[model samples]
Target: MRDFSQDIDWLSINTATIRKQHGQEVALNTLLDQCASAGIRAVSPWRDQVAAVGLNSIAAQIRAHGMALSGYCRGGFFPAADAAGLRAALDDNRRAIDEAKILDAPCLVMVVGALPGALDGQAHYHDIARARQEVLDGLAASLEYAREVGMPLAIEPLHPMQAADRACINTLEHALDMCDALDPDATGALGVALDVYHVWWDPKLQQQIVRAGAKRLLAYHVCDWLTPTRDLLLDRGMMGDGVVELKKIRQWVEAAGFRGYSEVEIFSERNWWQCSGEQTLQVCKQRHQTVV
Candidate 1:
């Protein structure tokens, strides 16, 4: 119920939203500078971008510019074809957790992988339930390290359509179930990253948000879903341009005590990505104010 119309003080940009501006990869440093200049306070940088720019250097830049991270993107993809692969993933996730702590991110978002190799049009395993189990096991291992390091893990439930490839955890309820199962004590080390683009269509959304409350809601992501969609992966809509009930969901979230950044996390390859980063950001601000 807070007013975003006056200023985008609560707005944060997920760097991937503008990773490719006008068909070119936007440098993380340049993007950080742009967000700061645009009065955007926080960001959530992907690991690849951070790795490309050197973790220490990016951490220094973030500190120098006084920027905040809404969350780290990301540290999950637990499913694998073999035990060695699983061990490697666990090792990589531990490193990711260390990196997240180094950058002082509030939480590291988890995009729990499904079906092993389905992302590349070939699946190593077709068992969705098994994938979910792997994610839970991986999270349990990661959580132990996270508690020691004082970092939080956020499980972001991808949309149902992406269940086969991106994430098997595709509902707020499902994500919350994992949190409850793992961190039953309501520990702050584990929670869910609620993205409207993914769970906006779920009938149980409001109830789940209330169930999540403040402690289990680690991050809030926003991006409208385009109707008559083009690419399933891309073609995300700007906040006001699509059918997503942005304000209604935010109210549920805020009422549940989640007073955090409404991070814009669109993956628009056809529309926004084809436009200048400046224009895309300007629209993000306007939409954040008027619609979100």
Candidate 2:
């Protein structure tokens, strides 16, 4: 494993980690400048953020800072209420791919949606299997365009606790299975964005990482999971503050040939978000060196 303790050259901050700092939504350009000033060599910006600050402008800013994107923050949400909705989702994903191309992102990260309206307090359907099937179909269609554009798609399997709304594909194994089924040849265009906060609890995580190897492991996200969790969606811990074995998991990922950024992607509304973005990033840098 690479020695992060000495220098965090591979550290990348997923802008979401510090999006809401000091209880406010920090602007994308501001966040970008902060990340560069903090010596972060890479970032993963959400699509909405890029849209807010025009794609061309953000692309220019990223180039000015000489920073690279670990991955683009999102292009999946395939399951929908109807055919029209599914088509709409695919269209949006294509636009996302174009934007990712503009930003020169390494891959477009996917957060496959489940149950359509589940996140909004109600679900369009209760069948998890159907949602998974929809995701497979969606990826199949999107992968074709993604390949033509030479853009890679990285599916991010959210924690099972978020299965109802965030993502139906919750296991690394399941993500890879879909990858193999859709891409078949282990092409670089399809893979998974392995987030530790989601899969750290899986007993088979190490084995699954090995199975993914380098081709299927398109991106690697890092964040600790808090105990006595209050909000399942917003309560995330910074590294070392939670129970996740950060170093151990990184060892497994690296052993499997994943040589990429350890992108910090936390969604801590009550904790880190309440602090200054600078402070949160400083902690991210410190913990990344010592624990992650």
Candidate 3:
């Protein structure tokens, strides 16, 4: 494995990690500048954040800083209430792909959606199998466009806890299955974004990483999973603060030929978000070197 202890050249902030500073939402431009000042080389910003700051402007700013994107924030929410909704989701994903291209992102991270209205606490249906099928179908359509645009799509399998709402593809194996089914040739255009916070508990994680190899392992996200958890969605720990074995996982990933950024993606509303962005980023850089 590469020695991250030497420098943060391999470190990339997901932007969401420091989106909120001291309880206030910081602008994407401000966050970008801060990241540049911190000597961070890369970032992965969300579509909504890019939209707020304007696509052209953000693209220009990234170039000015000589920065690169580890991956794009998102472009998957395929499950919907009806045909019209599914079509709308596809349209949105296409636009996201274009935006990701504009930003020169390495890949567009996908958090394939589950029961249409589940995130809002009112699921449209209780059938999970149907949702998975929708996700498969949605990915097929999106991949067609992604290939045409020469942009890769990285499907991020959320933890099972998020299967009901955030993503139905809850395991790395399942994500790779979808990749194989869609891109049978193991083309670089379709792959998985492995996040430690989501897959650390899986018994077959190492085996699956070998299965994914280099071509299918498109992106990697890191964040410790906290114990005595407060909010399942918002509570996330920094590296070394939780039970995850960060170094071991990275070893497996590197063995699979994944040479990419260790993007920090934390959604800590009550902890890190309450601190200044500077403090949170400093901690992220420090912990990444020592523990991650």
Candidate 4:
């Protein structure tokens, strides 16, 4: 593995890690400025953050500061209730690919949707196998367009708790299985975004990392899982503060021929978000070196 203990040069901040402070949302432009001022060279931002501030302007800011995007946070929600909904989802994903190209992101990360309306408390379908198949159909269609656009699609397999709402493919093995089937030739057009927070608890973790190798491992995300995780949606621990075995996971990732930034992607509403962005980022650097 790379010697992160020496420096945090490869530490990229997923902007959501510090987008909220004291329970209030921070503006995207200000967030960019904060990252720049701290000498942080890269970030990954959500589509909503870009839309809230206007894409062209943020694109300008990224160029102005010579900043880089590790990946784009999110371009999927493929499973829908009907044909019209599915078509709309595909159309939106096309737009997201355009946005990722605009921002010069390395890959467009996808949190493939599940159970239709599960996030809104009512699941249109409770059959996870059906949801999984739909995700495949959606991805196959999206991958064709993504290849034409020259943007790699990174499937982010969310935590199993979110299998009903965020992502149906909840393991690196499962994500890689999907990739292998969709892009049988391993064409580099599709892959998985491996987040330690999501896959750390799996028994097959290291084996799957080895299976992903380099081509299928598109992006890497870092965040600790708190012992008593309060909220499944937001309560995330900073590196070194929890029992994720972060360094061990990094070792597996590196052994698989992957080399990239370990982008910190914490969403700690009850803890870190109560602090200033500067402090949060400073801690991110410290943790990236020592723990991750």
Q: Identify the candidate with maximal TM-score.
A: 3
- Write one digit per residue (lDDT tens) for candidate 1, span 1-292: 8988898889999999999999899889988988888888899999999999999999999999899999999999999999998999899999999999999999999998888989999999898889999999999999999999999999999999999998999999999999999999987989999999999999999999999999999999998988878988888888988899999999999999999999999888888899888888999999998989
- The RMSD (Cα, Å) of candidate 4 is 0.8
lDDT of 2 by residue, 1-292 (tens): 9989887799999999999988999899999999988999999999999899889999999999999999999999999999999999999999999999999999999999999999898999999999999999999999999999999999998899999999999999999999989988998999999999999999999999999999989999988878878898899999998899999999999999999999999999999999998899899999989999
Candidate 1 positional error at 97, Å = 0.6
lDDT of 4 by residue, 98-177 (tens): 99999999999999999999999999989999889889999999999999989999999989999999899899889999
Instruction: Estimate the lDDT of model 2.
Output: 0.93
Candidate 2 contains a number of clashing pairs equal to 0
Clashes of each: 0, 0, 0, 0
Residue-level error in angstroms, candidate 4, position 66: 1.0
RMSD of candidate 2 to the truth, in angstroms, is: 0.8
Q: Pick the candidate with the highest lDDT.
A: 3
Off by over 4 Å in 2: none
Those runs of model 4 whose alpha carbons end farther than 4 Å from true positions after fitting are none
lDDT order, best first, reads 3, 2, 1, 4
**Candidate 4 clashes between residue pairs 3 or more apart in a chain or in different chains:** none
TM-score of each candidate structure, all chains considered together: 0.99, 0.99, 0.99, 0.99
Report the error of model 4 at residue 267, Å: 0.7
Instruction: Tell me the TM-score of model 2.
Output: 0.99
What is the C-alpha lDDT profile of model 3 across 152-204, one tens digit per residue?
A: 99999999999999999999999999999999999899999999999999999
Give the alpha-carbon lDDT of every model. 0.93, 0.93, 0.96, 0.92
